[model samples]
Target chain A: MTSDSSSTAGSPEENATSSSVSGATALQDVSEYSGADDDLQKEIQTAVENLECCQSEIESLNVKVAKEILKVKQNYNKIKKPIFDKRNEFIMKIPNFWLTSFMNHPEMSKIIDDVEKEVLQYLTKLEVEEFENINSGYRIKFYFNPNPFFKNEVLVKEFSLGASDQFVSESTQIDFRRGSKLRKRLRDYQKMISKAKKRSKKSEEALPRSFFNWFVENAEDSNDIAKYIKDDLWSSPLQYFLVSDV
Target chain B: MTSDSSSTAGSPEENATSSSVSGATALQDVSEYSGADDDLQKEIQTAVENLECCQSEIESLNVKVAKEILKVKQNYNKIKKPIFDKRNEFIMKIPNFWLTSFMNHPEMSKIIDDVEKEVLQYLTKLEVEEFENINSGYRIKFYFNPNPFFKNEVLVKEFSLGASDQFVSESTQIDFRRGSKLRKRLRDYQKMISKAKKRSKKSEEALPRSFFNWFVENAEDSNDIAKYIKDDLWSSPLQYFLVSDV
Candidate 1:
């Protein structure tokens, strides 16, 4: 009976030890899993931050390119305004002067119908498109009904005009008009340029490194350029522009 | 006599010791002077190196500004070309077309003598001079003519023309040549642009920061741009651009 009791005690003790050991193992696994979860969270946060940085870079680049294009367009407007107004003056004279000259020659009179159709096809009162397409040495119908003949025949002359065909010859002339489409397009172009200018202004603030710098000696008021005896920039603005690691 | 001899011998020993000390002091001072001369030489070398650094900065600054100005000019040229061409074509037609219209009018015929003289007075083959001067609205003279019509007469016309009179006609017409000068100027402008482009090509290599930026993404045959990218510039190109230092 004693032997039987001893064996039974041994079994109970062994079972208790085994159960405790298994519990310890399970606890360890839980702690390890928690540690892994923490690492994963950190990794996710890092990735998110990196992605945001990349996104910001892309946005600034987009705005910068847009602004530069706008500047190009603005300079164009300065020149284009004067040129466009001048173009209209010349275009308006085309049909008036040309039709008058064309009515002079018998040979050109036969081709007047064809030339009229050609001129009208490209002539939609939008002067720019027409002038751009006019070939320098190309032939066209010119009319010279010198004797107050309203319905005079036109002469198809080979017209290779430089900027101005000085003499009053039977030459191809223009009659340009300001069309609604052209007016709208110009307005749209201007609006885009203004928007780009605003975007660029915002981007300039975002690019901290692009600011003008003062020397170490005159760094008292780095914010104000006047602090520097020589307020001019020290180096190219490009030197400061940094790209975060992609 | 024994006491006296003892005192005299002691005094002689003291004197010899004092003389030795004095001689050692003199030698120490001479050695220190030599050491100080070496230090002076080192200081001069340092100062010279510093001066060289400052000079380099000034050179870099001048080069960078020049490049930026060139870039701006190039941008201007792209827009300037097309518009300028159009302006010339338009402007050249004004003189002759305007004059003919004025002369053809019955009312204008009365003061044709006065009109012709007025034109001759202000008439200039130089475009720069002509564009700067604004024409009055109207001046007429019955007897004053310059175009081989009338020799000397009081010439006056009562026309109100301001700065834009050449562009928009008011009362009288004038005869003139258009287009040639405009075209000629355009040609000259293009030539200047080409020279600028050549200058840009030479300078593109001098700016390593600019070159790296330009070619880091886009590869081109520009050797300077390529060199800047591949080579590690130990000394920053920007240090040389300082305009002044305190």
Candidate 2:
């Protein structure tokens, strides 16, 4: 994990200015400091140095903390993977299992539109696989039975943390079938957004209305959906699978 | 940490209802189930049981994860404590150190009112001490010079995690001095709110407008401020102290 280092140091001039600005206003009622107090100023400089040194030590310890946390995640993942695999086998036997689970998940359901809901009927399995490092990231694989919408058997979305520890994703292309209703709707939506953009210079980019659009959209966009699937939905699909009862 | 058990299991009748409800709407386009498919229904039940077993295993693994995470925090705290102690010694020598640090912090600055700012000028040393278990909780101690606002030498606010992993806090009594402006302001504010409540039934509870009010008001309220102090502000006070320059 990349630690923010911008605030680790400041120029002497900047430090002096900060001290005067904060000190003057905050210490107005308290005893005033004469500008000639060299010893006190030196002591404050020493204190700031010591504080920074402590911060460095803490930051290094944080690196160790991150490693330990990753180890814990890796160990737990190793234990849970086989169980998840067995659970997936059982899940595959149930008709409309993945579709029903998606609809029951609060965060997932919000992103899924009528078109996506229609398409998800053919979903056979949804698997989330974390990378070997665990810290690097994970990929979501969506397997489908023969469906009217597309030729692809599986659609995958993979998210990885970049060198700077930012999330970036890559998604598989969907081979939409000829005369696909979903494809036509997406094209019409794009056309309308382009027309709007021509009319107004400040018009925003087209937002994804359907889950498939969201899946194949921007690889560098916010990874909230990926996090939802990996962290919440994948770990406890049964929980969401039974949500509609209550 | 307490895990949510509400979604762990469902009654057979309820599970049957859930499957039917979700199956009916989400699987309308897909092939319909005849309801007389006893073999399929039995398989679904078995699958559900297996999935529930997986959930149980995951839940137990989570208990182990929590223990390991606590160990990581404890290890880091042990390495960081002595450095923090040395840093605190140096911090005590600097005049208005706590006040300056508080004012520089983004979240802390927002809660500080003019009166609280004036009172904080008397703040000599502010120390945050985590409980021995680290997971148990922490306390924020504010050491003050003899001032007109308060007679107490030090004010302490302690937060602890309850048996069910809920946060609860306890604060020391503030012994207000004669003709304390803060005490009078609070009384006037309460009187005004009561008057408003008498006039309108839909009136809401008075929110704490000052940092001092936030400290002594409700011990069981949201612990966002405590988290901000312990997790963000305390770990790297110098980072916030130098924020203004950037």
Candidate 3:
């Protein structure tokens, strides 16, 4: 993945940036280090190359995960595939890891998909309804809702291991072990961000100041004028509002 | 689902217990509360019936989950169904709820099945490798391996909504809400235990020392034995073992 020999080491992203910038009518695409001695230019070039290397690795990692998802999809039913080859075999097909993560996550309740919403409604209808408000006959209902294991911070899921039988899956053991991996990844991300900030100096410089100019310009992740400008630049921040009248 | 007018209303569990002791032997295998009416026979009978209702409900719940799994399996190619299906699919296939119960559980880890053993192995191998001292020359050597993940307690995962943009499906939102659901069930379980103890004055006579002998021998859940003994006979406290032994 390292083509550091290239003038920019030119990461997948940087190259794309370079490509966009080169499209201007009369502008000469700079050879990266604009001024100074040959030695300085080489040094700046090396730094850029290393940053590009990181970006390259990041791109490859993305590809790797993409490939993994595809593979998992292809062999989706391999182990117990035949057992669940038909519909209505299992009402809840959530994977164990995702479920564990979901149980631990805060935004879990809102993760409902179209199908789950339908299912929830079906289950809700089964709930014995009665007037919660006696005067108004405001009906209330409940269902066989699985109490989350982490009620106060922990859920109480019953494994099917039976009484007296407790067993932890390999994934669970890994769950605990994953902390260090996370910390390391965080550090990696931090480094990436730091390097990115340094690289952003030019991108920041390239950024047009006015709102109209910013909208027409290009940037990775599309950093618009609202994000880069000071608070006084615009009367309001650019953002999407849910359930908004405007 | 309950229709018998003579039944009590403590909880679904209470009904199951009563139904069991009240000539439930006709189904023989239907009720776990069967033959618990030597003393306070009426109350015990009522309680057993409630328990039967819960057990049946749970069984029905399992059936529903199974059917869902089947759907997910059929729609394995659907964005999130396969992932959810795999995790849930394994759970309902298990024998009892004790294994499923996560909160305030005793040492349910002692039981092992081949598949679970594999899962344990899969989870443990990562830890084992981490703890294992690898001599540079012997990369292939397999020896006394440590339980993995024990050394790590913090794990962080990254989410890129961008990835979902390119893929066929995005991951479902985490299921933190279910944590409360799980806790509620546990609390309910504790309540049942409390009520069962309140009726001990009558229940104790029914469950004589002889009956306890049989119960202690046959019962698996610590809570089950605790009820019969009217003491904390089976609470296996969680012992934090060193990572070396884990």
Candidate 4:
């Protein structure tokens, strides 16, 4: 995340240039300066260097701050684990619990189609596990009982902080059963897109409108859903579960 | 600030209402339940209560997390104090240091008028002191030499976190010199506004275009300038000071 220091400064040179008085103009004023002004400029340069040193020190302190904050978060996560486990156990007793919770979520509900809704009825559990570093990222797992749609009992989506600290995600490949409704629909959609592309070279292929597509999609630009699930839904699934109850 | 718990849940009833399935509809479905469904409902309620208990525990942990984070920030502040003091001492050696820094700032320069620019030329120092509690808010003080613009040695603006945790600010009253240029301009602007008001009852009185007015104005809605000064400029004034340099 560039440690807050770089984020706040935001390319100081760029900021200086974009200002009402461009840096070059200010420099021009400096170049035509009096002897007294030259002394002041030298003093200003010294002050600037000193300030930069202080900033470097603060940046180091901020790195420590980030580490300490992470420790605090990890400690709390440890304390909350057992409590969450108990909650998860109780939640599993109710039919369509995970499905209902997802259905009730504002963002989740928006992407769920009728076919996806039917498929999600088999979902028995949903779990979010943040990586040990916490900052590294998290994984979201969807557990399903014996379902006619897919062979896998569990569908997993994992997000990890890449080299540049951007969240990159990978998901478990869903093994679809022969003539599965979702599979057939996806094939038809792909065929239509390919036909459209053949007719018009400029045609852009649209991602299929289905919840399952979320797993295969590289949603680096729009990972809000993953964040919502991890930070919000994971923290208190009960609220979302009871969202259908007045 | 209502503690992270309340913010995350966000009035669950309201959320439930806005969902595709109304709570009442879900309730109606429950009402027409079979014997097994009734048993499941009872169990789900117990699960909900258990999950709520977990949420309360996590919320308490979050409160502690907030405290620890604040302590870390405060400790860094303490460590950075002397370094910042030294930087400030060096900065004072340069003429028009604060004025130049402000002029180079993208946000600060936008609000500075020509007369304000002249008054600011006399500005010798700027300091931003965050409240000890950190979250409670901070104060920004602009120190000026005995300039012809105003009588105040230091113009102070303080921000405090109100009962509801919203930032509320109060600024020092500027004592203008007799027939001061800024004072005369402001008077003329006020006269123009009153005349416009008399001509049309609906005339909106615009804030006078002068930098000194910033001291008297309540900028709660747009306190980004204050924030920039505190979080950005205060940390490293030299960057902004030398912004005019290549």
Point to the candidate with the largest lDDT: 2
Candidate 4 lDDT over A93-210, as tens digits, reads 7777777778888878877878888898998878888789876767889999898898999888887766653567788888999889977866766676467668777755543444
In candidate 4, the residue pairs with backbone N, CA or C atoms under 3 Å apart (3 or more residues apart, or in different chains) clash, namely: none
What is the lDDT for B230 in model 2?
68
User: For this target, which candidate reaches the highest TM-score against the unseen true structure?
Assistant: 2
Q: Pairing residues by index, what is the TM-score of model 1? A: 0.17
User: Which model, 3 or 4, shows the larger DockQ?
Assistant: 4
Off by over 4 Å in 4: A1-45, A163-165, A183-214, A244-246, B1-38, B163-165, B178-221, B244-246
Stretches of candidate 2 off by over 4 Å are A1-36, A162-166, A188-208, A219-222, B1-36, B131-136, B160-168, B188-208, B219-222
Give the Cα lDDT of each candidate.
0.28, 0.67, 0.25, 0.65
Q: Where does the lowest 10-residue lDDT sum fall in candidate 4 chain A?
A: A1-10
The DockQ value obtained for model 4 is 0.28
List where candidate 3 sits over 4 angstroms from the true fold.
A1-38, A50-54, A78-81, A85-246, B1-246
Predicted complex 2: CAPRI docking category: acceptable
What TM value does the first chain of each candidate achieve?
A: 0.27, 0.74, 0.23, 0.76
Tens digits of per-residue lDDT, candidate 3, B11-121, equal 121111211122344133223334454444344444334433433444343344334433432332233223323322332222221222311233223223233332233
Span of ten consecutive residues with least summed lDDT in model 1 chain A = A1-10
